[model samples]
Target: MPQKQIYALPNIVSPANPVIFNPDICNGCNTCVEVCQIDVFIPNPEKGKPPVILHPDECWYGGCCVNHCPLPGAISFNWPVQQRAYWKDKATGKVLRDSQ
Candidate 1:
């Protein structure tokens, strides 16, 4: 009999928390893990994968992870609606909400 091998998937299936990472865009540089002040992210054991969000609730929303990423949009925040602002144009009278 032969034994089957198990493998860890590096792709991010969904947004784990407020800090969302695009797995396709992420180069697995581990920069996000290093820059996180609160230790919210951990390096993925599997190479070439985005870091895991270990402490999602602990994130301070400081934007350090996003600002430091070499590739734009590799890391982005799913800002809570409470924290997001909606503004209306005085002339257009149209309200615009922050992008998701």
Candidate 2:
């Protein structure tokens, strides 16, 4: 019997400001994929999912994903002086602060 080879996935380089995806809210739509200019995500085969963060260090912190998700209270970020940890309109890119 021959043993199957396992491959190692590339690891995220860690961002200066760490951000996380709320799986509860993520529909696995890959909307973030179309928007990201930095190539931060790669498809997850095991999970049958779209782009997962391939390089967190490359994140521009531009809050593009935070603004694009249609699900309310989906994406967010926590940084000093600005805790815009909530979802927003994809068109206007406005965070729903009052709801939070």
Q: Candidate 1: lDDT over CA atoms?
A: 0.83
- Whole-model lDDT values for every prediction: 0.83, 0.62
> TM-score of the candidate numbered 2?
0.55
| Runs off by more than 4 Å, candidate 2 | 1-12, 46-50, 80-100
TM-score of each: 0.77, 0.55
Local lDDT at 73 for model 1: 84
Off by over 4 Å in 1: 1-16
Tens digits of per-residue lDDT for model 1, 11-55: 643334877789899989999898889888889999999998888
lDDT by residue (tens digit), candidate 2, 46-97: 4634347767767777777667867655456645335445678899997676
What TM-score quantifies how close candidate 1 is to the native fold?
0.77
